[model samples]
Each structure stands twice: as structure tokens, then as C-alpha cells.
Target: MGYGLAVLGLLLVLSGAPAPAQTRAQTQESNDAAEQELRLPPIGSPAAEAMARYAIEREKKEYRENIERAQEVARLSAELQKAFEQRHGLFPDDLRKLERIEKLARRIRSEAGGSDGDDEGSDLPKSLEQAVRRLANVAKDLSERVEKTPRQVISASVIEKSNELIELVRLIRRLS
Candidate 1:
């Protein structure tokens, strides 16, 4: 008990007495840091303040322009889609694929037609769904025609590639 008490006393004494020089050195180091910070240009410096303001304004301008460009792209694409539908009765690429499906991994996007600006898995907006369903019907008809005519399947049909596209659609449907 005496030995334990002696060890506890020693610990308490050591803890209670921090070397004075350590405190002095710490204060001097803090003062040096403060002096360095003070030597830097204050916010009152016109050039530094102007540069900061300019950077902020430039960033704001860039953000605004980006938004405007995205909106313009959406508008233009919608216009192009309408034109394509009017002139060709379906997506232009779909028409091309009907004519020749080779050398093109079926550019038919998951959503179909031009970009409608929908995020991934955003429930496939009703209009986009209708368009995709329409294309699916077209693909189904083509698949049937190819099956009916074996020689045509070898000659007129893009069987292997179309099969891949059909498989991809099936996978996407399962995922959604």
C-alpha cells in the first residue's frame, strides 16, 4: 500500500509540474505563426479582392452558360425528333436499320429517339415509353418476317446483330 501510494504521488507531481520552458517555447511558436499570418495580404487588398470576385463571377457565368447550352440541346433535339417522325414515320436510325442493320450495333438507345433529358431510371416518362413500345412493335414485326422467310433471313435479315439487340432489350427490361 505504501509503495502504491508513493508511485501515485510521483505521477501526480510530474503531471502537475509542466516545465516552464515548454510553455514559453509554445507561446513563442504561436507568436511566430501569428506574425507570419499577419504578414500576408489582408482582405482589404484591392487586387486580391478583385481577383477573388472575378473568379466567382467567372464561375457563375460558366455555370449559367452550361445550363443554357443543355437547354438548347434539348430543344434542338426535340425539334429534330419531330422532323424525323414527320418525314420518316419513325426514328431515322430505325429506318436505316430496317434498310441495313449491319455495321451498327443497333443505335436504338434504351429510351429510343432523341434525348428527352430524363435521368437514369426516372420511370421512363410516358412519351418515351410509347416511342419505345412503338419501336418494339416494329422490331417484333421484322423478327417475324425473318422467321417466315428462311432464305430472306440469310439474305435480307440482320439476324445475328438484331438477335443481340433483342437480347440487350430483354436484359434492360429485366433490370428496369
Candidate 2:
């Protein structure tokens, strides 16, 4: 009877004993899981709501700024067209105007979630006159596209038009 009791106790002790390797691995995994859970606030929590609101506000502000930039681009393009009409060639401030247009176009593209796209070998203007006219037309079109695009939507057409306008501005700058 004493020997049988000793054997049963031994079996229970063995069963209860945790393997060192498995215990260590399980502990580490649980710790990592807990750390990951701590990183993000629970869904529907106040912290999550605040984070969402912040993101929405930031987007709204960016949209407003982009609209202003688009308006500026339109105004500058109109002025460039008028200057070209008056001077009949590259004006004194034509380079500056082209540079501004390029900068604005790049900003608009980035804000509209566009990357720098490759020039698709579109028909480039050859002469300074042709380049200036094309730049005006492209800039006007880009501005219109931006104004028409909704705040929540990223328009592929806006991105394409901005890229085209940027390329046209660069070409005009080179031609001048």
C-alpha cells in the first residue's frame, strides 16, 4: 500500500510539473501579446474616438489648403496667359511664373495622393510661344479638375492633370 501511494504521488507531481522550455516560450508569447494589445486603444473607446476626430479634422484642413492652392494656380495661369498675349514672347517674369505654377502643381498632386509619374512622352511644345500657350491651358484644366473633385475623393484625373501641368510648366521654363 505504501509503495502504491508513492507511485501515485510521483505521477501527480510529474503531471503538474511544467517543462522549462515550453513554460518559457508560452510566457514570452503571452507577454508579447499583452504588449501588442496595450499599444492600441480598444475600439469604440474615447481614445479611439478622439483619434478618429483628429484625423478627420486634419483632412479637412488639408482640403481647404489645397483649394486655396488651386485657386492661386488658376489666377497665376490667367496672368501668365495675359502677359504672353501682351509681350508676344517670354516676358521678364515668365520664369518666375512658371516656377510658381510648377511648385503649386506638385503640391496639389501630392495632396491628392499622387506620386511623381513618368512623363508618358506626350506631345511636348517645341517653341516658346507654343509652350506658354500649352502651360496656360494645362494649368487652367488642372485648376478646374481640382475644384471639381470632392474633398473625400481622390481623383485620378486630378493627379493626371496635375502631372501634365507640372510637365508643361517645366517645358515652358526650358523653352524660355
Candidate 3:
């Protein structure tokens, strides 16, 4: 009991609280001294505050751009799905747009901060991989049809692939 009381007394002393009877003037003088001692560097110095602010702003811009890019990809996917549902052959422009969307998705997956790491850490990578695989499978299936009937490769069979693409777009939007 005595040892415990002594330890508690030592802790109280080490805590550096003011004595209970300290006068107002002494308190004010102590506060001024503490402020003077703890003064920061000059305002214009190369402080981490400025760097942190810039980094935060840059991340905000990147995140906003990522969301916009994801939305654009979703829109393109919808256009492709519509064309497929209409039973029209994919034009060169549609092919180009698909390529562009794929490129943008890859860029977002590789460069986005929260998604650059492992697949287990973020669903974006896994969804992106699945989307790419599904697209490749569709392309392969179409190419096989091209071997069998060269002119009929772009038929109603693409509707299923278009649905998969739409789901991929939804995943991308969720990521953003």
C-alpha cells in the first residue's frame, strides 16, 4: 500500500500540473513562457503542411477524373450493348470506342491509388480481370465463327457478351 501511494505521488509530480494555489499572474506568465518556448517556425518556411495540402488536392483531382472516366466507360458499354441488341454489325467506330474504353479501364485500374495494390485489397482489380477475360472469350468465340462463316461472326450471339460488358461497367462504376 505504501509503495503504491508513493508511485501515485511520483506520477502526479511527473504530470507537471500547476500547484493548486498558483496566482493568476503566475499562471499568465507561465502560459506566455510556454507559448514562447513552443513557437513554430516562420510561416513561409518549407513545411510539410504545404506539401500535404498539395498532395490532398492532387488526389482529389485524380479521384474526380477517375469517376468521370468510369462514367464514360459505362456509357460506351451501354452504346455497344444497344448496337448488339439491335443485331447490327459492330462498325469500326464501335470497335475503336471499345478499344478506348478498355484502355481507360486499364489506366484507371493501374493508376488509381486505392486500386493499385492487390486484388484482395480492392474488388476493382478482380472485376477488371474478369471483364477482360470475358471480353477475350467473346472475341475468341467470334473469331471461331469467322473461321466457320466469315461474314456471320457479328450476329445475335454477341448479346450475351454485351450483357457481360454491362455488368463490367457496373463494377467499374462501383469502384469509382
Mark the 10 consecutive residues where model 2 has the least summed lDDT: 16-25
lDDT of 1 by residue, 117-159 (tens): 3223322323533444433443444444333443312322333
Residue 55's C-alpha lDDT in candidate 3?
A: 77
Candidate 2 collision pairs: none
- Writing each residue's lDDT as its tens digit, candidate 2 over 1-176 gives 99998887788668965444457778678889999987978889999999999999998898888988888888888788889889887766877877888889889988888877633556887887777777777777887788788888888888887888888887777776
Global fold similarity of model 3 (TM-score): 0.40
**Structural similarity to truth (TM-score) of each candidate:** 0.32, 0.72, 0.40
How high is the lDDT of residue 78 in model 3? 60
Give candidate 2 regions above 4 Å deviation. 1-38
Task: Extract clashing residue pairs from model 3.
Answer: none
Query: Which candidate has the top score in TM-score?
Result: 2
Task: Give the Cα error of residue 114 in candidate 2, in Å.
Answer: 2.2
